[model samples]
Target: MRIPVPHWPSVAGRARADAGPLLLAAVVVAVVTLLAGAVPPLVSATADAAVRDAVRGSGADLQVHARMEADDGPGGSRARHPRLAEDVDDFRTRATDELGPGLRAVLRPPVATVISPTLKITDGSVLRTFQLAYLARDGGPAVSWIAGGPPEPTASETAQVPYGAPPWPVQVGLSEADAAALQLRPGARIPLADDQGNVKKAQVSGIFRPQDSADPAWRLVPALLSPVAGADGTGGTRFAGLLSRESLPDARLAFGQDELRRTVRFTPEPARLTWDAVPSVIAKVVALKAASGSSGARDGSLKWETGLDGVLRNVSAQVGAAFAQASVLLLTLLAVAVLVLLLAADLLVRRRAGALAAARQRGMSLPVIGGELLLESAVMALLATAAGLGLALAVAPGVSWQWTAPVVVTAVAAGPAFGTLTAARATRDRRVPANRSARRWLRNTARLRRAAVEAGVLLAATGAAVALYQRGVGGGVLPASAPALCAIAGALLLARALPVGTRLVLRRLLRSRRPLAVFGAARAAAASARVLPLLVLVTAAALASYALTLGAALGHATALGHATALGHATALGHATALGHATALGHATALGHATVDSPLASGLLRLTWVAAVTLPVLGLLGLALGTAAGAPERWQTLTRLRTLGLRPREARWVAAGELLPPVALAAVGGPLLGVLLARLTFGSLALPLLTGADFTPAPPWWALGLVAAVLLAAVAVVVPVESALRRRRRLSEVLRAGDT
Candidate 1:
């Protein structure tokens, strides 16, 4: 003791003392980081599901078709032989080369096809015109013989069949259904002629059926499977008469090379598509189109056609809308996260205010104190953020820097900023209370600053609204931040109204004879300066309500799509060709809020988490905000108790203090939610997610449920907080140097 040992704080002691605030900060940073990190992957999954759905629905239109008229040699020299196989392979090679690797990966091998000009077969008085179709066996669907076997090639060596008098007919096959519709069976022979007077005697060699009609092999030439109604005013059904691969040479001899149309088709494999690949695939398709056009113009023969570009463009638009919709939920989460983080920071600072002030009195510089706090916050926040991002990557597998970085930075910085401000304010508490005039001047200055902030928020909200409205009306895309901006503006407005409403209650209570009512009202009026809790509660309430509304809308839209799909299936008599019903059934089985396939499950999960988190965050924020001043409140209650205030009167005081914010949020939240929904739904394109449109109105029951839940939470949390304050004994309050 005589050696004068300096009393330095131990690291373990500081860690123990700072544990509560550090844990709180860690949790906030972790949760916000996790949610932000999950967004990119979840949004990507939902958009990918939409893309797959669009591609699935496009059917044959989703494939690329290159069609060209088979040219006959000049002057009918007939010396040069056409190599159909070599020509097809060359076409396939060119197409794949033009499409690029990204697009080529998702496409099936090209299907080469040849079609003869329209030829009529008269069965009694009714005529059925059909095209003699030949598909390469290697790339087409597997077919089963329903009656006869495959057709045989003609035994002619010359092009034009030598104009023989008794030549064998070209052997052709037809689908069983088409054959029945045409009134032709195996061995039936019919003389068919085109408009150019070119004639061919076709003998029915077999009736075959596709093993899987839904196979992509049947997509390009649907007439090969079913009879299509002719639009040539002949009132005849059109059919694609199937010809064996060996019949190509005879077909050219019978129909002439110029009379045939040759095509190469590439069907898209929907399973291989992803949201990230859409733009690249579209670009490749565009390049392919340009290449084909230039080549076609040069040769005056080859041309490529496809609707894949249009389909991909639609999917890209849908992805944009989906991300915009997701932004509303994520931004709401972030806004509330920031608010709760600040409230938590304020609580941490309040707990350290005495020590910080003592340190200031010991001649510590403000910069030094701020730097220390920043380092402490940075260390804890960085650890939590790393863990959270790691967990997010493990769960969803993608990092969204724009969303995650801001949340992490804000969560880390909030604590140090609040601590520095609190330290500065606490050090000045040594001065005597300001006189009335000085207090008035200070209050006026604070009011002016608040007014400026609120005016700026209002201006921002207005600009966002105008931009969103213009975008929605003109392009059907709402600006992503519009809903969040409006929510903040609405919350600020409600915060202003809170004080006036409490003052009105105070006046009414003063008029009453009951002393407890007056006391509770006066307490509520004094607490009006605490606007953070009110803003958090209102904004959170609005977000919860808005999320519920969107959920219900999505559910309704999904159900409507399911119903529509079922209706189509019923109308079509369960035709496999109409696959939308099956797709919607799959979506319905997953849940009522998502689209087809398991990829869309992330959307439902994310929305549900947001819906649950927003309300809980509000409740936590309100509790933390109230708890920040718990010591002062308890001290005041202790003094009142000494003056004969009853326990019932104390409870009333606590309830009154909480009632304005609770009631304001309960009433204003649903209204703000409805306003935000109205503003967002115009460009949200909810139908893109579920394939059905719904009314924009918030369901009455859902609104009531959200309001009731918020009230219930506040009712429970406020009383619990009040009871916690009461747990501190009178001796403890006095030991804390309460006067």
Candidate 2:
């Protein structure tokens, strides 16, 4: 019977009761889902600020805080690499500090610390020793300390002389950062005195506290804060974090972005005068050093690493680019996941055609029917988007959201478009002629068959990679699930080479006696069986290329560190006194001792700067913006089946949805957008670069996985719900049997 259709109000009450709650729930879900991506920008900004702040000294460019090595090995030989620039005679000229570009910033970090003991009773033995010290007394604010109370005026004056020459020349006190690092709870004494023999003991009265701004740092007087001599200047022993700023006037003008100012007392005059006005500064410096005799040579190889400012820009860019590349990939994947879920939603609308048909019989027009059907789609899409946004903001504070008019418009527009498509398909499918039902059934069956075939291919490819991994053919590069495309092609050529094993299992599991459960199982099996080939192909091995490439790169970095260590050891008879050792040396360094060293053996290594190293962690976090919605849908379905406990549901959601929703799309995206704006849009320019273009593939791969995991759940959950209500529909479709 062609049933009479009614208007919106006629069936509005019934429709609201059935689909209203679910649709509302969908909106909530979308809101929260989208919200997950909201806060990433803010966090990134904070982190970036902290990192830039922490990169305090210009020397951070080439500085390794400390290094140790064994010297005078068997026959005075040192492990060194020939290819390295350690002992190269030509490098001496090339490494000259005459580069005009390097004339900008000069931030001398803490020279090192000194420790003096007036009294010490270890193992029931008392020892008194003057300590060797570095020039840390009254140093400028390089580091800050957090302390309460105060420090002692006088130390016990018992110090163990670990390595100090008599008459120690100059020594600096420990920095607040350094003091904490050593766990020398306040009251530790620094060895003070030019005389290494009678090195006076200085107590750790207090650490220097530095404010973020230079204004505060300059105004801060460590000695005044913790006066060593006290107000009356009669204290026996006292300590203070001193900053030597005699060079401040000089430093003020000399300190540029990545350069330091050095007071070179001599620059030799050209012996033969040529009107070429630009004096060979390096040649002059070398000549001056030669004339300064042993005094200048003692300083040795002063390579003025000017032009640090330019390097800083490049380095920061390189780092930001690498990480941002990964971020872009994640974002793309996430966007894709949403689209897929939308696709699945369209599919579900088709599946639920009978429900609409039943509604039509109760007097509903096509438009009214759409209002009924679209209630769910509108709800889910909005909810997922909202949830994603919420998750993003909550996790990553300071996320700058660009509520672009277009994006908002598109999202809003997608709502009704999604509804219209589902509504139209469902309404049209309901009225399909009876002659086409056979065709529809055949198509579904064919789709399932195709899915099964794909699963078989994946399984075969995985097996091959597994075999290769066992034989150590690939260097764990394919450890995840690398594909030898050639082998896969070969497997494909073998006509009967499908994964029959999975089909058998599916057949067994779907053989249930119960109706709904059996039907669900059958439907899932057909759905999943076809998906097996794709799943098999998505094995960890498929991700082997990423691990392999990154692993090799990291290995190269490790090798560089080794090479650096080797170079240092070969230069000095022993590994030179490193920054760590400087604290123990008090007095003057002796006269110039030049021993031409040979490159005895090769030690492969490389040196690394540590200042901007931690930024990688943030990038690691922000690379999860894309994921599969199906994973989420499936999980939610499973959770619902498991009694739909709130905690369990949340847990599943977090594990499945939080990565892409919170980190990538919301957090990272916001960070990227905000960072660009915060710093004059410098951050945004990089986005349109080659670095961004690199990580696109892997990002897409993972992003898809993440989006699929989440979006699929939404589609699957609704489909499964509708499926449960399918008993009557199934009966109606069944052929009538006669006795």
Candidate 3:
């Protein structure tokens, strides 16, 4: 069945008249689709980067280090220590063979020594003694140098010193602090004595600086030895230095072979790899361990260590958990969007009901009418989906196909299906009894059915909440359905109670002598049509209030964590400066500093932004829902105006009609939201608030803001709509007769 071409123009005109509500329905689809398409990939990328940063900063990736173990004879007598270089070489080869291409970079430091040496100053006064370590590898110091650049090569490949320095007879580098302490520059000769009493005259070749002393990377760099003038009563400052491979024989000779061998060991430090590469590296490590043996011991019975596997697993779990939480939010937003769209579509259908009934009277079948409405809805859905996709692309350029495809399907299907269903349900014909009473519309069976449906939804939501609580206890991602189901059940229950409560309050007001009070009560008693809009408004308010409360609480906890970490660092710094034998104390302090870094802060901000923005969208939908009912309201006020009600009095009556529901929602919605949030917090056992003394504060200011905006909307829309109707004159409205 086709819509006749001659009648197509008439149908199109009717559609145009319903354009306002239709557009609102389209906007809801667009917003939901955009959020669904954009959030996942962005969240994944952020999580991956954060994991990578943490892994790199902590030096937790795959590492191979050699240690000497004494071999025992058959009777348990100690035989000999394992050969260092040979064992390390065998382990490196086996690890490389096992990891293959997955291995990033391997670092091997040649044999060296950390020795306390005294610098003989030009003024014949020694600057005191400090510890200096020398590296015999070219790239070893390059990894940790923060100043004066890395050492440059000499004419021969055997030696490297500071950039632009002439070849020293015996090359040595000093840390920046050491260079300043001895007032020594490159090319200056210094006589150094090791603990073994050997003296070597060496030229200061370069000055290099290590990273922050607390950084794990600082341990990787050789420091320059230096002595402080006024020490903190223990001794002078100790710094490390790096030297080329050519300088190794001198170090061995000065410090002795046994001492050097005991002090220095070869270790492989994995270079920084991309976050995506982490899983493959972890897999390789696992395979290497499995292939090795039951003990999984490396050469020389050395222990192989890598925290990359655990870090990656934890990060992946965290990403999954965060996405799960976000999914609950998305589901909630989608539910609200669908509700708003259906309400708007129903309103549009009712506005066009007269035209539809007239068409039926002229012999148009229901199927043809339904088909036309469905086609219109499909077009709108497609257009809105296109707009939403474009917006999603603009907002998150790196969004993957995995995120976009499902959302697109949901966007395209949901809008048209809801629109068509609403139109069909609203346009259905039912014969009216000649003497039908209002009491018949309020039948006990109808109330019971509605109550039963709400009860079923509430029971399902309760079951989901219980499941979510169990999942939280077991420690994994919480299902999105938990909170979403709760919100939906709460909204349904609120819808059931609100109209009855409002009627009771207005019935009491009807006895008052105030003209506006009586008029508003009478209007509200007859305004059953406004129930869905009130429901939508209250739900939006509740969700927004909950989000704001959660965001503020989490934000406070995050700030506290950051401050606590900083305080620990400060105390550690003070202890180190006091010359206490407390390197272990410094490590403990530094460990606390990693709890709340910039990456975690960024994630919190993203969460808060999303939380706040979602409610704002809901409020927009609520405003549109309110505006859709304006024409009927304007006609009612215009009729009252014709009965000698002043224009100002009519405006007052309109305000009175709108304010009661808005006020009730403003008070009740946030309270319900807070209750829901508290239940969610208990069930989820969210880590954000764990170990912190924080209480969820109700967002009273946010509630007030929502209330103010809604009241302002009523004031503006009602007055503007009424004035427009009055300007058209009473005769015209009567002639048009609600068409």
Which numbered prediction scores highest in TM-score against the true structure? 1
- Candidate 1 residue pairs that clash: none
lDDT of 3 by residue, 148-234 (tens): 433333234322233223313345677777778777777776655554544555666677654444433334332343344323334
Query: Which residue pairs show backbone clashes in model 3?
Result: 223-240, 223-241, 224-239, 224-240, 224-241, 225-239
Ranking by TM-score: 1, 3, 2
lDDT of each model, Cα atoms only?
A: 0.70, 0.32, 0.56
Q: TM-score of each candidate?
A: 0.83, 0.35, 0.74
Candidate 1 vs candidate 2, TM-score winner: 1
Q: What tens digits encode model 2's per-residue C-alpha lDDT throughout 379-417?
A: 445555555566666666533344212233333344445
- Could you give the candidate ranking by lDDT, starting with the highest? 1, 3, 2
Writing each residue's lDDT as its tens digit, candidate 1 over 358-404 gives: 77678766776676777676778789888888988888858666776
Candidate 3 or 2, higher TM-score: 3
Where does candidate 3 have its weakest 10-residue lDDT segment? 158-167
State how far residue 316 of model 1 sits from its true place (Å). Answer: 1.9
> How well does candidate 1 match the true structure in TM-score terms?
0.83
